[model samples]
Target: MEISQRHEGARGTISPSGSLVAHSSNSKLRPATLLSHSSIRTAAKEVSTLKWSSDSANIAIVSNKLVEVQAVEGHAHPTRIENGSGSLGRFVGADFVGRHHLLTSWEFGRAKIWDLSTGKGTDLGDLKTTCDEPAWQQRPESTGDIRTVALLTRLAAEDTLTMHFPELSTSMQPLKLPTVDAKSMSWSPDGRWLAVLDTATASPSVYFYTPDAHQYRSYPSAANLEGDGCLGVKAINWSADSRVVALSRYDGTVVLLNTITFTPLAVIKHTTTVEQSNLPPHQQTPIWREAVSASNERSYALASQPVSPPLSRTKPTIEPVELGVAEASFSSNGSYLATRDERMLSTVWIWNVATLAAHAVVMQHSNVRKAQWHPTRASLVILDCGEGIAYLYDVATSSAPLAVNAPLPGSPTLSWVHTAAESKLAILAAARSSFWILYPEGAESVSDDARAGVEVGGELFEEGASEDSLLDILSGRKPALPYEIEESYTKMVELEMGEADEGADVAFDDTFREKKKADTDAVDPLDDSQIF
Candidate 1:
């Protein structure tokens, strides 16, 4: 097959025998280059989810009945495992336990660890746990080892969360939760805290717990205060440092809380002005007349009809209405927060963490499917709007987001793969026939620099600073530094001298010219007698 590659300014297209083509438009930010595209056949045509191994060498694609593990670096045959037997039920989800082992869960709260090397599946004991979705503790620093996994199970007429250590084959004591209906759970990046979101309560709350199943505190959502009948949190995101947590509520507000002190920091409300659809009398009268004429023409029309007055002409007024937040996430360094509202599906709000102000607003033509920050780079975000294009926003580099089109057909889902050497993105097309991996050009050095900039005194700058220090700095309550004081004094003195010099020059020059002109005029007036 003949392959053709074309480039026009910031845009690029690749065509292979007209079967597949990839297009990307350049921006101030670097565009992702299509590295590899591969097609694989599966028993099921749809893909439920995609996950990358910690090493970034393999990817696990889960379907309804089977799990497919594909290698990224080679042309190796994909491994398919169908562990769904009599009581095991269907495969719900799968996560990489390590580089060689894969943990697959079932609908009946059963789990199995499949060894990819030997093609062996070992089932865990009858734990009767709810494995609908398991939240694995993230350990970025570890060597792809399964540490602790949290699973939910209904016990004693209430939903209970339990921890299981896969390697040791032991489970932790069941932790009693405040709400019986826990919507979801998330572990901090450092694996220090676990946050469980409870939506099935009078007031939705987010409970914080230690890794050892110790409940520390809970923050009840403010959604019920609007008298909206127990609105819940749609999403929860923890800052990279695990210090601040953002809760996206269904009441159109995002609450940011200080996890250290368990107090609210700010409540961000997203409001949009909508024009009322009340039409003017002139416009309504024409439509009413047309309808009346049409009704009179009908053969079976009623003889008596009620006459209705036309509405008075008035200008439409715009009123701001709050929109529920659909998604919210913090950047890698916690410098920026990105949120998407449910009503306004095509717009993204990027807020500055330091100033609590909007840094950028990204509007797309299509509804956005996902907006995720880079795993290692701060202020960089990737958005997929199901338009076969990926929009990238890097606040540190540019104000405008860049667009990169996928090589495959249909809407594609995105997953970021971070490795020791570089970071890559996996785009799975909607058809599930093929997938592509893209690597952003010139992103490695930029990511390295961003990671280095956030580290201060051998600890993350966000985690090292105390709450009081940050509050004082943000509120402008700190004392001025010596250099700042001296600089202010110098600037004040310079401004005063400059103004005085300008005033003196104008006054002296004007006074001297006026005196000279007066003297000449007076003499001329007296000497007029000689001419006579």
Candidate 2:
């Protein structure tokens, strides 16, 4: 194929025949927006649920009433596993081995090993779905509530992956559980531990399990959970480093737990009722005036006003921040964390992992269901904002996203692959029949320094910081300065108006001159000579 190129001096475009044409610019692509998209459909069945493994190149989608598997690089057709029919198919943690995943099908009353590579599934069996233990049957009065069903996996020393399903002993058939209707279950990144939440109990306990050793550990989170969690935890996401797992409870509490030891990191208190507390002494100040007794009957005017009855405590309605922790995800590089609220306001919260403090929040209109940091450009992240739209957000700028990229074939599971050689591609589970293809529009080929600049916007403009600290602020956590917002907004407005302004046409220029002359003709009392 003969490739043709045309250069238009400082600004230009080239169309090459049968070859990918490249554009080089002294400045990065303006707006850095999602220009266009193509559609792809999945062929298995309607994908009701899906899970993307961190390490693997496959996505486990529960379709056709079975667990459907597709390789990240594979074509539209998925290897369908017909087992787990009529069961609530759950994608548990993927094993350390190749594309093997731990799947729990509530209908089958068992967890299964799904070999994505072989398109096969092995039943690991069930736990007592109900708390119907013989010990309880013997002493009916003392029978406690059997709460949850969980599946945990551990890789043995010989590399064989073992799955654990907690059981309640029975006489006739061991009354194997129908499977635990868990509130939430999360696996550590290394796949060494699993955490389960039992909402059925009076005080739900967070259980930890290690399948390799065939052991179960429970946390002491016996906080009398009040609300009936029938809908249970909507979502759960582990911190990038796997040191923390954020859980979103139905009752509106986003619980953060240290993964190593089941300890509460912070119980972020949230209530629909916005309460106003008394202002601190330093913050509360009253301006006063000196009273003068002029005559016998002195009239004194109050100068500084008394603090207005500490603004009436009105219930400020803040959107429920806790929408079940599962709705959030950590960046591949572990620099930022993101989640969405009940009101559909998706927030990308960039953090300093070392300090665990939030640095920035990228607010979007749609309720974001999934988000991941670009594997190569750690500061570049993409979000699946439910309703067919996906957003590519540069964690660094206040400018609204360059452009909102939509997944083809509609709502598909979006994921990222961080291979050493692969271009950071967005794998979207296409229309239940295909996987939509997405590649980084502009972030793919940029250097880390350039990417960092895009990620942090103008944070690099600050003075007196070390190179390391500057890099951190550019790609890490640095509160945005007010100027950044104005600058980004200005740039966005300019981009919308078109980067290269054609200048005013003759007719427009004539109108502009007339308007200018009319404005100049307005009366000026101060200087008559200048006014004329």
Candidate 3:
């Protein structure tokens, strides 16, 4: 199947296989057109993973059988790489080492490095790692240098974490961890800390360490003391600033940690009290009311509702009830966080970072397959719900989200592509037969009216802005201008209708003299004319 894009008057139409038509407009924040590269094709039946290069100029799509690298620009044909002899494992994950080379890991702990220019693969031998996947360092931008890669190898008695520096052709000595079975490991965006989650102990624990493998702290997961089985951790994600990390547990709880202090900031539990209670009084039955009352102890209910019993009175009675596996992610600017629970797969909870409270909640009709914030846009979020249409949520704008229709078959996955020209969203179909690229026509700037409360003393104060502003300003680095500061100073002043009188003039003269003396003492240097 092939996808085609055509323009008709002010609207653009996308026709795939001559059966589906998606219309787009330029005046609103909608996808304008679709672009599909014809030269790239997958040999396997489905795509297991899709990853963009560090430079964002190419995308690597790995299938269960093979790997294909396609250039984002031009009409260049895709380069295909296959596994070497005696390696009988399927590809699990892949990462770009630099701009020119690719690292692909497979089952049974086998890996290889492929040269894109020559399409040749070099075996790295068996890694014998406890986890099938390797954790690669994430870079904000392409740095034209080899990135540091890490692998967790399991020994006979203990587990070891090793760092590999491809540029220097050297590997760090294996750092033995306290746990015997390490499930997975990840590195922070700033590359200052490493996190390892192990499940071998009686209760799962997450360990934090420095770059050199010095263990500083460890936090154990809260036990299901109410007799519910422990589900353990499902995933780990780091914030853009590297100051906070989110751990998504299988028991429908999300734990936020402060990397600097190594302490738990908050624990979010998934509950249906708020959602079910919002319905009309007729819909709330006796059974629903009982459930709501039982959930009052653990749910993060809205603040406007009547406060529940204090923690001191309800601490021992509360139980970490099992809902389902949960997923959480932070926005680009770290101002908002989004989460979804498997039990309520159609609902998404958005939390404000400054207040650590719920900002907005969204509910969809189908199961939400993926929800991600735009790479550059702070307020805009893209979501796919196993349907033909994609939803855009602008939390700062309207109460309801906007939709864009692209009728692709099977479940769809979404990823944002950051190119030099513009930012595009990639929608990969489940069949692996075709994929569509969407160009957002226009994006509305978040209004300053919503942030009027935080605008103080001609400077906008935000949760994550203060830490970097002083350092950047002192080092002569220019900071991006805020939307609130774009208005002119003259427009902010108000004038009274009546004219001034002699009495007002006399008061102004005295006030002006007092201000002048204060300014001189504050700005002028110490001199002989000044009194001690």
Candidate 4:
């Protein structure tokens, strides 16, 4: 009510208040619309999950008690699926099978498929396992085509997997599995194989199978990746083609395996080091400490403070901590793989999937919250830097970072828009707010596939850009110096801007200062290599 009122009293009356920031003109993304889910109200729902359909026309919102399908273009769903008996044993997971069906699982060994088109529901037999990590195979390319979906649930009788045709209400051949607690699983891009990582203990045992559950190959324990050989698996992701499987441990060691033969392709150990860059005010980067103990609450469940030390933890370390891969993702084309060096603001590694070697080590950001490949482009990538900013990096083009002031309302989810004739991206801030980013053509920057990769950042070092050069480029990794140096540097930048009458844009002024620093600073040229 106050936002629409003309009566002036205080800050609420100001339409363009100082707190309500206006976006910069240098950016190409224009706000299109904001969609709010304020109508969603129910005590039974616990943090609803939102997923878009292949055509980007509908969204499947799954909550603790019900799975609701909402058409994105404001089309009403004429029929609703009957969710049998509310609160079905704690909703474990859910996903869209094809374009018209939503597959959901429950913890009490129950799995159900709901056909959105017909509003018909099918109940599969008891899964006999803790239902979690339910993933669907690649959807059919043709719209409205039935999708083949697989569910990996360990039954009390035996560890077995079930396949189903939600469209026809029929079950495929049930395949038996060897291990329980399948920590992670994913489908190959072609929908032929299912890769399952079963880490019941510290031993990282993995299995690959056809959709029918026929085991193709059993992989050696990535427990070997651990010093004690006891830590369980942290994360696993399949390449775009499903030919390669990337598995990571908590200690920042990434191991890639060939999906066909289940053989280790490459093992990259990510350890931080200092490097040489003469950009003034060189300071030593603090060592990344490993997580010694986990709190009773999950990391995501804990409330976040508005301000805290960038890389400081108060708990004293009695024993040495080990770092592991926090998150890992494959590019859309499976040409590149990126891993988050757990808990470290510096040290995000990119690898060439074809060569199975480290392609580039980017020690540039304070923290990389998330990384995902462009939907169509293989070399292009977008990174969410925990803060309100997002960066675009094109390893195929340059090694500079393009910063965008994208202030997401909550947890950031950046996805490419799949609508035809619209090369844009969408940002979903929590479940309430939505924003569309349109990089207009010929507007200095456009989201075109052919001319896309250019104008991106991260110094374009050769294929094997060594660790030293990357560390040198990262401001946080210089040599450890007193805190006053950082403070003085900040003061210097502020003073320079003031001397110039604050007439220039802040970004441009900072860029000019960095340019001047680069010209005056003496440093050895960066050396690159052909590790591939």
Candidate 5:
């Protein structure tokens, strides 16, 4: 099957089988179009396992846990310290600071500051309630109130560590803010300000904190919210210029706002019901309904316009956009945005700063999340598509994604190192929870050519196999796995919208409601009179 993608003026179309069509005014895409064509295949018939290192990468994934850290490039992975009987909270977020320090925080009540260059993890302190010390210039009394902290380390070589420790601040401090719960957090590109999603109020609002002054500023006020219906704010992305912020709400509303003025730039709404109609004649375009009628009247009258009769309307359906698993990320250049839904499909969308329509739905991933742009290049992106698979895509051409056959002994997470002088290579946290330095096949590198080549083929040795046997079995491999199978799958069958309807506007009546009601009502096997 040939897939064709095309751009026409402000809107773009993807013809999965050379038949798809859509219309839009703003460049930002509507979710309806994304769902119709952005179906990614989740099944990977074949996969490979990977090696690991924890210190050299920013993120790590194992089993159901994800770890984010800024470990030294050459040091051994830092030892994890467990305190009390509390759970060991998986690392949720991490960032490198000035090339020397790695900071981490978790959903569990703990945060740590580590020296990445020396592999020294200093418990610069815990946010636990017992450590509060007004005498030590530290507020240990406020530990339980803390929820999440956003750490910022501008460069790996920098000396400062900035953290949004609202939960640990004492009353004597100048900025005495409420006990806030952070749902999301981000830093300005320049690293001067940190923005937070404050869920402490009836209507959650974004708050800004300046590290130097230890003060809080409320830029966006509560009056701006439309209602409680807007509360499902799941994710946020920052513009590269630090002038705008894009937010995603669970209700399917994606909005871009002016960071300085706190004003909405555009709001992209989503819907699932397909609205079908015909276009008017080439000479004169009529209203949608009139155009449909005119086409049916002219049996063969060769009208100049192209039109078709209207089909019956159907009830508008709302397709659920997964709230929790989807994350918002901005391209390095800030010209576009990308997100992955819970269903395993990811999309790169062109962002029009002025209007909200998505100009193009660049590509989709079948089972990937965590996508980021090449720090020095404009078009390239890397993503982990679960199942030990990863992909690199060139946005300019929405063709087949470039496959990166890295071994992910198990599920893995990815992180990018920013490079000022060269295109940075991705650091993949290996299956052992360690990190590996990976350079794509054609990417430039200065390492010695004597290094071992990427292991492209292998078979997992049985439990009874020896180490030497395993090494010899997988070494110098070709068509390595004799038991592997190859097969092709048909493209996803389009979910037919609205059942064979009385008209296009009608909706299907659910039949299970009565059954559920009978189950909860008085036990009656003979409710036949009310069965209808």
Candidate 6:
């Protein structure tokens, strides 16, 4: 079935040799649709990414050499990006910032925005090549894609840049806070607030921006968030309902804030040990220091004084959320949050959005590929837990989740498509030569058996001495993870890897000797004219 208006009619694939071929299928067992490369263009250029216009009338195939936007109807010549431009660099990705503007990221780490209406492109002006915040201005009513652009340049005490449309009009305004070298700043998804994080100071320096009120509030000023999140905020997520925001920190602490009141709703501290390094426990400093010291621009007397131990190092404990390779996804209903982390064990934590409490912890063996809630079923969640295994975690009932193992397990790549109409959720997992979708219900898998088995939050991988619950046992002895305790050091590890080739070890001592002898006998005509 056609997924949407833009993806209607047929499904397509781009070959490694850079060819787009269409395939048609009404169901999983249907025959494929095919087209010849000779009918299209048969050149062998590597395609880095492909993007569709919001309207789905055009598809852009991006590569190091060019960006070609092809019409869906396969009519006329594709709009080639390099047709007239001479300074275009090798691009690895493309962002359709607006319908009329295309932002291309270069291999050199720079970016340029091109205006489709005028055929003119403007370099984002030598901004940090790594800044990921080049975004189009967002307004619910503004849909035609002629939106303005906000370009973040140097994070070290920088200005907020706005480049107007058509004329490419420009404006610059310094950040409302005195965060010298902002380090990183992000606008909430709804574009209602901007959160600026500064790592320049010895402690965490965070600020929030409210555009309508033209107000900037520091972390300490926000009630309840005072003295919170010491290891620094790593990422920020805005709930779709636009009521609350979640700030996750390096220490695995999560703080929630209310938009309307600018107040902290909850502070979810991890089951981690707080170890003080440089200063003794008595000389500690609150992570959320006020306008004190050189942390924030507003001058305070503490900057010149010695460390005064913080009033308290205590935190309120909740269920321990593991630290992973940094991944979290909010449910479509905005009522749940799923998080995966890397630790001695791998787990998926689903939390109730309103209470910020763990509703379930899905323990498994494989790294979680993805966890997304069903579009229509608030209690249903689909999980892609590597090795062709899928699970339907129904929180509505406290039973082991339904399990379905597919035939494909060799794939190392998988991603979720948007939740579709009715109750369907599409999965686009990479197979051998191409990628395909698994059924919304996930691989003809029936619900797991009701009999008791080794289970972790209702997930069963295996049970044996090799799989002892060491961390679970250690956590159980602590009563609660957030109790105040003196800082202590645990462990440190340094890893080094050397690059070696299998064929590099072939005997070359005799070859090197012969080459040296040949060089000694060779004449140097250029040496005679040297130093002129």
On TM-score, the leading prediction is: 4
Measured with C-alpha atoms, the lDDT of residue 308 in candidate 4 is: 23
lDDT of 4 by residue, 446-484 (tens): 344433221211122221122221122234543422212
Question: Across residues 89-175, which tens digit of lDDT does each residue of candidate 3 receive?
Answer: 677878887777787777776666665654444545455555623644432332464456666666676777776655554567887
TM-score of candidate 6 to 2 decimals:
0.59
Whole-model alpha-carbon lDDT for candidate 1? 0.55
TM-score of 3: 0.59
Summing lDDT over every window of 10 consecutive residues in candidate 2, give the lowest-scoring window: 133-142
Error of 5 at 319 (Å): 16
- Model 2: per-residue lDDT, tens digit, 366-392? 445677676666667776656555556
Candidate 3 Cα deviation (angstroms), residue 375 = 1.4
Model 4 spans with C-alpha error above 4 angstroms? 1-47, 63-65, 71-77, 84-94, 116-119, 128-132, 135-146, 200-204, 221-228, 274-323, 407-532
The estimated TM-scores of all candidates read 0.57, 0.44, 0.59, 0.60, 0.45, 0.59
Q: Show the colliding residue pairs in model 6.
A: 155-181, 155-182, 156-181, 157-180, 157-181, 157-182, 323-342, 324-341, 324-342
lDDT of each: 0.55, 0.39, 0.54, 0.49, 0.38, 0.47
Candidate 2 regions off by >4 Å?
1-107, 110-123, 126-184, 211-235, 269-326, 344-353, 386-389, 396-400, 405-429, 432-436, 440-532
TM-score of 5: 0.45
Clashes of 5: 33
lDDT of 1 by residue, 1-532 (tens): 1111222221122221111222212211111233322233333324566666765556666666657665544444455664423345666778887667787776666666666655545544333343223534433344465577776656666767677765666778776677756767888777777888776344546788877888877776444333447576767888988778898887778989887756788898765532223744332211011111343221112111222222112244476544478789898888899887777666677888887866655555556788888767776788886765666767775445666655545564665544332343332233233344454453333454343322111111121122112122334654422112122222444688789998785433222334557566443221111100
lDDT of 5 by residue, 1-532 (tens): 1111222222222212211222222211111121132211111111111112222232211111322221212222222222212243444434333234445444443455444333334333333222111101111122333322333221222212233443333212223333244444456665555655545243545566553435355433555544654454566677777777776766555667776665678776532221223522332212111111343221112122232222112343586444432566667777666654343243333444544444333233233456777665656677665545556666545343555556545565554434443543443333332223344543443444323222211222222221121122234322323423222111111123424343466443333445456454542221111000
Query: What lDDT score goes with residue 352 in model 6?
Result: 80
